[model samples]
Target: MSDGPQRFAGHQSSHVDSDAAIRLTDTDAVTARYSAVQKGYIRDPFTRPLLPRGAQFQPSRPPLINVGTYVRSEGIDSLVTQWLELSQQEGKKCQIVSLGAGSDSRFWRIATGPHRNTVSAYIELDFSENTTKKAMAINKSRELKGTLGDPSNVKIVGGGTTLYSPVYHLIPADLRIPPHESLSQAFQLIDSAEGPILSPNLPTLILFECVLAYMSPAASDGVIKWFVDYFATSPEGTVLGGIVYEMFGLNDSFGKVMLNNLKARNVDLPGVEPYPTVASLPNRFLQLGFERAYAMTLRDIRRSCIGEVELERRANVNF
Candidate 1:
């Protein structure tokens, strides 16, 4: 789903904790997805399970938001599907690590979708509090816990903050912290008697959806570089792909207004300020040693990548 201004501001700014506002962004994301699902803009049965019980019933987001969510979800789904298919073509399964993953049901979707077998491992990392809540929700849901294979294999460790299955893992992590201290240690849990959860030989895809904008450029780059270095020594010539969905170009009038609004709520976008234009978005990866990278706004994707039927459907929904 798209992380628009409306979604970021979905929760009331009444919490005294600073990171509470940050964590609520996940609430905004899941609720927006629920809204889109209710409006016939998307199909996601798993999203409902991940949402808090209190937020299960809510009015639909505006038509524009529904459309944006549709486009954003479709676009990322397309890329992830392609990654999985590419791994299949190479006779290999891929690993996906979603940083700052909130109440996202992507792993469940991929595991049940056609590309289910193409994923060797699916890992999600988020703040400890969010992970604990998600872990509890998954623990309580039959549909969600069942997808992780045998209930016996599922272990809730880290004092119920981490859940691990054969193919899926939900771990608590704060991305703003140093990756070496945070990521490297957390990954150790994935190394089992079978092998490491993240094989250096396999193609890996790092997803940074609506996350990078919440951190400093240095911290965000460190996260990407950590992954880059992890696969750099692979003799198999492993390919590491990255996808970042964020807001940029806040110097413009509309952008300034959006920035000011977030600022008013104590949410600072230090990561976005570095990339003021779509043209500069690729630099986020390329400069960090990615062989290639591309940036496409929701507008361009809607105009070119989306089919006429979908556009017409969105138009009808809007009208």
Candidate 2:
């Protein structure tokens, strides 16, 4: 419903290896507001403000392919902000950790916006190479850096993390490792940032944006199961939520061609075969110890946010 399966209908590597693709994608995202890019996201007020002052970049695809990217970013921002506000209204402490959050500016946008007080802590996890680049991007920009309280009090540690921000933290940790070991280290960073030990029992939300699809099903399963087990038994009644945005329908007609293209690059999508459809994903999550799981499709994004009227208007935009 987000109005552009037509947008995605038209859709890699730099210095950091496989992860470089993510960074470059984000690089394009920051400058997407430039009039020359012709993206619908040029209208995304949140995105433009989050970018550093002079982010110039080249287009990597025909503009149509990026329509879906911007729409999805807008939709996800709405989703996360809605939840954060709900948690705040309920008087619950909240933590949101975005997996593979490459140069995404959700935290800074939310922190400085009207709902700035909604979340207690926000953490971003990515490879060190990407996180360091993001940190520098934030620090160099007076606008980006201003959102994190007093500028002089801010600090980055281990080359990729902010060790002293009360609300914003950038953590560089490998998600492919055992979840307990990797996530515990991430939580400790949060503990330090927030000035308290993170209880196993805390209201937390984990966001995986197409990150799980790159992993083997076994690895993804283990991570989800690990989280379920860790928070399910908390005496304080910690409620947990996971918001996953995954790529599915691979091995099918349109997807098969795309999958093969990625495979040629030696990118193995181990999770594709195991959970190949959005419908299949919730069942997979339930089986992995998630008591309840929900999924939103592209159509849902269109219908739920942008209405049919706007969709038809965009349909007429010649690309």
Candidate 3:
């Protein structure tokens, strides 16, 4: 979902002039969400307000894609809601850092939800171009801007590429670069009189939705390791959870077809080449010194993670 500097083996650059194509995936992701919202597959009041003026008129995606989007969104939502609830159980508020967050309404959704107070901070990082567009969209939408508390408290920085508020922050970052180099800009920003934007004492959750696939394994690992080390220096019991939604098992024929389909558009999945199976996906974090990690497919989540009644409800709702 992000197009940053990519480094691969035996090649200086495999994706020359492909940043635009990689960024186009963000448009596809947001459009898919909008389509699902329009089809009643999901309830997202914020997606529409943040979309481009004429994006809504585009035709809805196919039924299969809509259902897939529903499952993926619900699955991630379950994990995030559980993280917030867990923090509440511990009598603490948690923070969420969503990487490659392109036109995602998750921060707005969580800020307005029941567990809003359970979240101490919600930070979103992405390419500067995407962040600039999202910042403009947010500033242009009253409903979106109103959720950030007092208008006086919200200000756009980085020449309108970044927006800051009481509990929400949108910062531009290239995940391909070193975390210290790319992420220090965010670390330097002060959320309030609170000293630092990110609190090391609080539990944090790193959300990677359809990201990391475009970068090399080393780059992606560095990003996660940076967070791991950052929290390791914090107070004890500072939990860190990561949720990465991506496609794996690309060595098969079906995977080949999917890869070819994407390659036709000039996009590559270098990171995915390392984790080819569901079982191997956890190694992405486990090897980074995380205590535990797990991976599940959308189909698995739909079958066991969701209730039968909810499944029936979704099934009965046709496009």
Candidate 4:
């Protein structure tokens, strides 16, 4: 009978506290982009504005980190390109949903690029803070102004509401906390297939860029199952698939380092232990009702896909 008011320090273990902390950790991806080119990571010409005005460099990443970035970005790029081309050929439109999209700059890059006409809509969802930062940047920047529409048309509201534009929509919603409940709530904000926003009948690419790893295994599975459910019930010829990029400790020295780094950031890899291998990656989705599933490690991808020449060139910037 000696308990008093709970201490604030003990609340650090709560989900709310962890979620906010991990958001800061997520910013590392943005900082890394500025040094990606110099570090031989990858080419990203549209990510600078998404970062802070006077952000510092973060070049002290695993050299092989470039391979991961390449695999994720190149893979998405290839998928998006093909999706766009096929849509153009079929004279249909498609949509892209970027989960935990933290000032990613993908919409602008894709919308203004050669395949600009292909993508009908691009939606980025994350916490309201991140969405607001991205929305504000898009509002203030000239590059992203006409990309969506007259800045006046862009709508920004508080939590649970979406910042809607003609092409790009920055939505603030929790991913998979509820059993299809939160997603259902978020759906109310989106236009239906018959409406003008994005065609629900068309193909969709849902990207989880190192986002799911932070979530518990059950929660991540909920996300996959939700998509499968949506595809199963949606109109015919509605293609749906996704890609997940994450680091599962390899049980090696590098794995230990990665684990320690993330732990230091107060971000726990809850799902990593469950699916630790490339083969295990796809099976996670296959079990969730996906027709096909495929995954490869960064090194395997570098050796087989990038080949000797490109890998050799990339090796110049040793980690």
Candidate 5:
């Protein structure tokens, strides 16, 4: 919990278990976790693409702007692409799981006609309270359908709904704990009547975007290991999909600048680790029995866009 730079002075008062403590569950809490200066940098129109629109609170600059957004966006795109590809190959129901999916509108963004049919289910995992808030927001937005007109096709069902329709399942589980146990229990309870149940061969696409950076390196390693181990429970040829991670430079100029600013404010984040290089990530995957897979950097994506903004991409592997 005490991994990175303390962005706000008042944040220290809330213990990790405190209700006021900032966690990934609430969008505001997640946004406030970033340094004020970083928040500013993300708001800049030119750099806005790096950060998701939902996370941006106001227009301001932070010491670490470009690196943050670039990594986040690239990770999101990577996972989405992997999910779509896996669905095509398996020719079975596709299950898309978003870990710490904070205000990401990917389900709506990519949910087109044929594409929607490919995905049998879309699950967004976050804190129970946060997920409830998101569902409420979606429902309220519907009342103004005349104006917004159901922004996303996400249907808010009281319980689990049909697989063909877009359903948002808010599984309130904590990432810091063992996710598999909780997930197994959830599947048992939710997938009782849903024939075949949740299996590895069901084309599961798990995504962790902008979530790993907040955790310590050991924690991140553990999380990845858990996923690999969980997938082993599935039948052979059961692909675990891709694990997309977006990380910022640890020793980059921007990082140093942010550290100095935090130091001046009398707040220290001792456990913060810099982004891991691409070459190193493949080995991590190999340790978990995952093959060294495809990867791309934010720099390459920006280059393809032919924009003036220069972004840095680290070697990322898809496993």
Candidate 6:
């Protein structure tokens, strides 16, 4: 069965409030604001390059026993760490592609820092609306820095213009469908000037954080298949960096308790049949033609920030 874009539209608004939910038409603007809010809360100074002034502000969490922080910090940090390590690998320049990259600053932050020269390309793929917003943000940053005599190293790639420095190529393609075909068109536009995909000597790392769970199982499977197909065919070997923070089925008393809580909140997630243990993620990766390079649970971070939580899994995939 074929699913159009709206297959997931209803699910999107249910995940967050209207103010925080990413609109298909203005996803880029929403992403920028979301990133600004995150940076302000995490106190990450690097976010200054992407977020506009006065964009930083704190949101009040639900009083008493809010477990959302664990959902954000550990899951997000693990994904960032994986991407950073891939970027800093020795001898070869790596290409980092962020899938559904909502307001992520790793490219800008890492590119401008010690690993700037080590990265061959930093591509951020998202909805066209969001990608355009990011480009505008990057251009605005360049303008602001020019006034201060300190220019940024990021460059927007699509729309037929290419600059010399580390190009922040924005391939605005929808991932919910066949990304390879759409992405191929975008890359052709980019490859016309930027040369070719970065060499295979340095691995390409793709990051997917907090995105799959929101997708239907079929769409999620399509996404995984797209990545596996890309890496299998691409000249470069690709490593997938993924953070899965949503609830899966419970196998034990602990798992049941977690599910009950989510059920109480009227959230029903698909994908886990009879709900496999979170540790079963490695098996899922292997099923999708990816070998698990590393896996860790952010239970500690969850405990510290959001009280006791049953499961959060982070893994790195190599093909």
Query: Model 6, range 79-128, lDDT digits (tens) per residue?
Result: 66656665566556667766667556666556555666666776666665
The C-alpha TM-scores of every prediction are 0.92, 0.81, 0.92, 0.84, 0.64, 0.62
| Comparison by TM-score, 1 against 5, better one | 1
> Cα-based RMSD of the predictions, in order?
5.4, 8.0, 4.7, 5.5, 8.8, 9.0
Report the C-alpha lDDT of model 4 over 2-105, residue by residue, as the tens digit. 01122465465433444656777557777766566557667766677677666645445566566556565666677667777887888777788888888687
The runs of at least 3 residues in candidate 1 whose Cα sits more than 4 Å from the true structure, single-residue gaps closed, are 1-16, 317-319
Q: Is candidate 3 or candidate 5 better by TM-score?
A: 3
TM-score-better candidate, 4 vs 6: 4
Q: What C-alpha lDDT do the candidate models reach, one value each?
A: 0.85, 0.68, 0.86, 0.71, 0.51, 0.51
Residues 167-201 of candidate 2 have per-residue lDDT tens digits of: 77787767778877777766675435434434455
lDDT per residue for candidate 3 within 1-319, as digits (tens), equals 2335646778776566567778778888889899989888899999997776688999998888888888899999999998988988888989999999888999888989989899988999988778989999999899999999999999998778889888999998878888888876576676457667888888999999888898889989999999998888886758999989998988899899999999999989999888878999997688898999988888899987787788777766766
Number of backbone collisions per candidate: 0, 7, 0, 0, 10, 2
Q: Lowest summed lDDT over 10 consecutive residues: which window, candidate 4?
A: 1-10
- For TM-score, candidate 2 versus 3, the one ahead is 3
Query: Which whole-number lDDT from 0 to 100 does residue 168 have in model 4?
Result: 81
Clash pairs for candidate 4: none
Model 1: per-residue lDDT, tens digit, 1-319?
A: 1121222356776435667677887898899999888878888999998997789778779988888888999889888888998888888888999988989999999988888999988988888888889999999999999999999999999878899999999888767778887787777776589766677788899999999899888998898899999899899899999887888888989899988888887888888877889989997688899989999999887877799887788657533
| Candidate achieving the largest lDDT | 3
Tens-place lDDT per residue, model 5, 53-167, is 4666654334354345444554456557656866777676677777776555566545533466676667766555555455555444433222222346434443321112224
What residue runs in model 6 are displaced by over 4 Å at the alpha carbon?
1-41, 48-89, 143-165, 193-201, 234-276, 293-295, 300-319
- Clash pairs, model 5 backbone: 37-61, 37-62, 38-62, 40-60, 40-61, 41-60, 41-61, 41-62, 50-69, 278-315
